[model samples]
Target: MYKKVALAIAFSPTIEALISETKRLVELFGSELILIHIGKKTDELETQLEEIIIKTGLDILNTKLIWKEGKPVHMILEACAEEKADLLIIGALKREGILTYYLGSVGRKLIRKSKCSILTLIDPRVEAERFSKVVVNGTQMEITPKVISKALKFCQIENVSQVHILNEIKLYAFRMATASKGSEDEVSNTRRKLIQDEIVYVQDILKDLDKTGLKINIKITAGKWAVELVRYCEAFKADLLILGDERGYTFIDRLFPHDLEDVLSELPCNLLIIK
Candidate 1:
């Protein structure tokens, strides 16, 4: 689905691993790779980047390298827009501290404001690893089908074996169902019915998808969406988690902490946020 993939390059310890992952994604998606570095252009830096590209098995001549001097977040987002990047890959910490939540980090800012889809690697390795288990947010939204489709496309390309689609039942709905003066058995039945309905909803979405060679598992979860999502991913030992950003997030939402914010604060796995 990604026609052009971009990597926000930083000469950090994970640079080699990041480049290797980016190269693999570009080759898999059949996309033009764009490397964006937010720093002054220097011959030494250029040479180093070239060496890394060659070492990572990416053709330096074929890759588009961009060097710009500006703020890291602004420059990276600008480059992604200018390059018309369908997907932007960047390295991210597995979990950010409390200070980062309020102050905002480069990775979080990019996730909040970037116009294109983003893939944040929590633990990038020099030797790229395969994504065998994938968990997709099957929340009931207009953008859910598109998110699932993109996830399935990636799974087909990567040959993922296990795919779990998680649909969450809102806590408020459950509260409302039990608010009525009902017996314990009635409340239990209400919860069971809610879970069944969510399963059917997810199945309907998957009915039109091409699930070839994939073991599809539909899970109906309850409680806070983001917290439950993280718990599910951890429990399932998912290598990748795909989520749909139907509506862009705002600063107020960040302060109050919404579903996306909760997930962003502590990534359970390599996150793929589809816009």
Candidate 2:
């Protein structure tokens, strides 16, 4: 049922693994694969890409190859919007340079701002997580029935049990009282406001999801959004983590770092990012 997917391949060592995983995903979901190669303009690389395609037997008609002369993240976002892709697949190479990868430098940029769901391949040797034991993370109220239905289909295919819903809400309190003065009332009021807002937000989301017949475990948490989400995945022994990515070009995303450190770094399980 997942028809359109945009795959951002670095054309590095992960290409072979990516192709193999693509085959598995297509077989499982019956979706179209748009393979994109991001690198400096070079005909040799293109030829190499083709050779790999032939070698891997990823010669399907639905597969596409794009050679763009720009930053990888920007070109990827453009492609997603143009193709109306439902998902984005990229490779995460874990190396010694952690700090450089952070601070909005490389692939992390796309991870933060991608409009469609993102599936990051952690190890070239490993592909595909459990079809069952899936975890869903997002605002419950915003999740559509169609999305839930699709998720259910995946669960059924994988024979999964226990879908955990993650709710993330943070609270902050402060006032500029000469940088030294603090008011107890101000702190108390801020706490009260945070609690009230969280209650309202969660209530609305829960009401909508209640309509779905799927049984799920509700997990309410506060603090950093992506970190806690990954933690829950680890604790529950979830095989897959599902998230919803918004579509289209987002100006704000480029300005900030992608907040999926735990999900990418501590990839104890596979990730399924859906739009």
Candidate 3:
């Protein structure tokens, strides 16, 4: 789905792993690779990058390298936009400080502000493994169908057999249904019906999707959507977690903590935010 894939380059230990992952994605999508570094470019730095590129087997001639001096976040985002990248790749930590979340780290800022889709790699390895088990957010939203469609297409390309579509029911709604003045049997029926409705909703979305050679599971979770999403991914040991992001956040959203904030605070795995 991605045409031009751009990576935020750093001289950290994870650079090789990040570049390796980017190489896989570039080859997979038949995309052009653009490596962006937000700092002064030096002969030493260029030599080191070339060595890594050769080691990673990324076609040096096909890759475009960019160097800019400015704020890291601004430079990276600007480069992505200038290059018209369809996807941006960055290495991410599993958790960030609360202050970073409130203020905004490079990763969090890009997640919120970048127009292109983002892939955050947690614990990236030089020997990258294929994503075999993926969990996609299937919560009823305007962008959910597109997100699921992208996820399925990615799974097909990667030959992933196990896929889970997770849908959520708000805890308040579930509580209201169960706390009604009804018999115990009635409460049980209400709970079952709610779960069934979620399943049906997800099934309807899947009806028009191409799910060939994939074993899909539909899961209904009740509670905070972000919390349940993280729990499900951890419980299933999902290799990647895909979700849709289209809402714009305001100051009030920051204060109240948006659902995406929860996911960004502590990533469950390699996260792909489809915008």
The TM-score values for the models, in the order shown, are 0.92, 0.66, 0.92
Clashes of 3: 0
lDDT of 3: 0.86
Residue-level lDDT tens digits of model 3 in 3-89: 999999899988999999889878988999999999999999999999999999999999999999999999899999999998999
Query: In candidate 2, how many Å is residue 153 off?
Result: 4.2
Which 10 successive residues of model 1 have the least lDDT summed? 94-103
Cα lDDT of all candidates, in order? 0.85, 0.64, 0.86
User: lDDT value for candidate 1?
Assistant: 0.85
Candidate 3 wrongly placed segments (more than 4 Å): 94-104, 248-257
The Cα error of candidate 3 at residue 112, in Å, is 0.4
What is residue 236's positional error in candidate 2, in angstroms? 2.6
Order of candidates by lDDT, top first? 3, 1, 2
Model 3 TM: 0.92
- Show pairs that collide, candidate 3: none
Q: In model 3, how large is the Cα lDDT of residue 245?
A: 80
Best candidate, lDDT: 3
